[model samples]
Target: MTDDQTLADTTPPAAHESPAGGVFGDPTAAPLQPPTVRRQWSIADILAEARVPERYARVCLRADLEADHERILTELRTLIDVEGNIIEAEDASLGEETNTARAHRLNDELEQIKADMAKATWWPRFRGMTSDEFAVFNKEHYPKKDGASLEDYNNQLVAATMHEPQVTPDEVAALRKKLGMKAMSNLIVKATEVNTQGGVDVPKSPSSLQNLTRQ
Candidate 1:
């Protein structure tokens, strides 16, 4: 009958909702729990999980080849100096042959030595192993010493995991012989760095817009 009474009768009840829960109901009712959040995987994330980081080590099997390379380089530098003097002095001859001719001969020799050295160098690729894989590898290849400390165990783990998948045991033995203990240790360090530290160098950005577009 009264306007105020009529309005009150038609009006809906006020919601006794929790601000945090955003749930509407009786004040005495429990608040609704939030829905669980889940991680969404992108293509990049999936690929990253599946991808294995790789590293390469270059080892020369012939110390003699390295020596020859250095010797030829020295000879080439000396020949170049003499060649410059010959041109300045206008001398056509040096011993049995002209400096220009001898310089060319030395250049040929240097090139050949470089080729030989390149042939002797081996590029071995290594991939990082998963923790489970590394554990098994360590047990098989480099077992922990008795009463080993944590540091020693970790060191052995690293040493065991530096594996060149392409090379055979005989090839590895040959490499060790050529590299010696010091160089072999250094190579292992490099492999470990790549595996643990993501040692692939980030390529430099293009210097100009043209280069970027070309790429």
Candidate 2:
């Protein structure tokens, strides 16, 4: 017999005697439903369960780091929008002194924002380790993909979030067309010499928030 079957054969039945009428102690009780079968595991199964703490911590750390990574990407997108707005304003200025002065001020503000972004402590202390420490952590916590190390994954994420535009290429083409038409309209308005009214300041540039890593 198999180990489980041999063990089951030698095991004793429930020690307690059934009550007078039934196990439920009711004389009129219908036959009790068979007890639900519970799962049984051997020594190997118990040993496997012991690894929960280590695995749980690793999973939690990965999830937390991923959350922070997303937050940093969001802040980066805001910075890009601000920069794009400055570009649009400069483009529409058409060499006007007031517009040029405004553009300079915006540029200065953008620089300050960039500095602050660089200074932001987006990751936790554990995640902010030295390069060697990070390598060790990645080796332990993250599995390699297609022969690339953890550092390769990290670099890919950085490049995608920081350097790539958020929108699809098709969407970017459409946005360019829209911007071109808007610019032409601005030029027409300028040529007409009509008194212009200030409009709401909204960031309508192509989004810089695409998850390029998936690509």
Candidate 3:
């Protein structure tokens, strides 16, 4: 199993879990299917379950690392939670904490979970399981296409929660025109000639921008 997949195994199922809308807004808006659960097991737990001999386990582990080593390693260093906003619930559900306070406190909790999880020895010892046993264990657990460990699964969770949805190529072009996030910025012109001196303080015409850009 991959590290992220293996890492996810550490998280036991919550007795009663519910969707908590976080930084990315409503979960319903950009719905991606959820990752399947794989129970987290300790080193001994893995050994007891798998019947593989030592040599083959090492080979299986090494091969997985070589396939996507850099990307996998980089993901480990990347923070899983969104910047600032860490509370795993909707704003209304938060009850009293203001948005600013919620962000600050959630940041602390996310950092601590990551720090403690780092010390767990799930990945380093996977190399010891027999390939025969690994195949059996892996089939039952690491089902994601490229998944080889729990860490990969954790990264997937992070991706689902925080990764922004992609805009299509056409949509990107349209948004660029609207936001003025383009190669060449232009000074907006108003037909009424409001403050013709180009005073920065005056309100720029939002309604006219699209028409002017298309021209």
Candidate 4:
């Protein structure tokens, strides 16, 4: 053999090794397919894939009900809060309505809500609060015969605890109850806005999601 031919004939073949072993290493193995690139979800892409053009509907809430709902919500929250607490004779000066009267009104309003609104969406928010939680909240905010603002109450509480190295169990309990009440207020406010039927206006669909039958 010539020098180049001799070198070619004597050289070992490259190892028939495959990074992907098992059946993949076989000489007759299929070619490695490229990995798929998943496209990110996009609202515009979703719209483009639709078989039909989208339509829109408009809903209008009653202006007067929208305006008054806040007052109603506030009253309900207060009623839940002060249901069985010993309110000082002085703190009772806010309105002619006694705590009993206020509570009665709240019950009436809740009955009205149950009658008019979506129970699954709205009722659970306020109903979850226990009587003790409401009482603690009312006590924390409206102390018996005390004209202290919430900030003042906090400041006094902090000052009282300043000498201590860590919060006492009672202090911790009080703080947690105060936070719970604040959280309940937020939840109640949001629940008050859940259903279109709660408003004086007729329930209507959004400007989007047009009804196919209507068109």
lDDT of candidate 3 over 67-166, digit per residue (tens): 3444433443342355533334354553665544645555555565445444431221111223454345446544566534343322222222221342
Q: Cα miss at 191, model 3 (Å)? A: 71
lDDT score for residue 143 of model 1:
32
Best by lDDT: 1
Q: What tens digits encode model 1's per-residue C-alpha lDDT throughout 97-170?
A: 76567668777887887787778776666677765675576676543465333333333433444566554455
Q: Write the per-residue lDDT of candidate 2 for residues 36-115, one digit (tens) a residue.
A: 99668699986575321100001121223344555545544543555464223434555555543555655566565555
**For each candidate, what is the lDDT?**
0.54, 0.35, 0.33, 0.38
Best by TM-score: 1
**Residue 18 displacement (Å), model 2:** 88
Flag clash pairs in model 2: 166-209, 166-210
Assess every candidate by TM-score: 0.52, 0.17, 0.18, 0.22
- Per-residue error (Å), model 1, residue 49: 4.2
Higher-lDDT candidate among 3 and 4?
A: 4
Clashes of 4: 2
Count the clashes in each prediction.
0, 2, 25, 2
lDDT at 14 for candidate 1?
67
Candidate with the larger lDDT of 2 and 3? 2
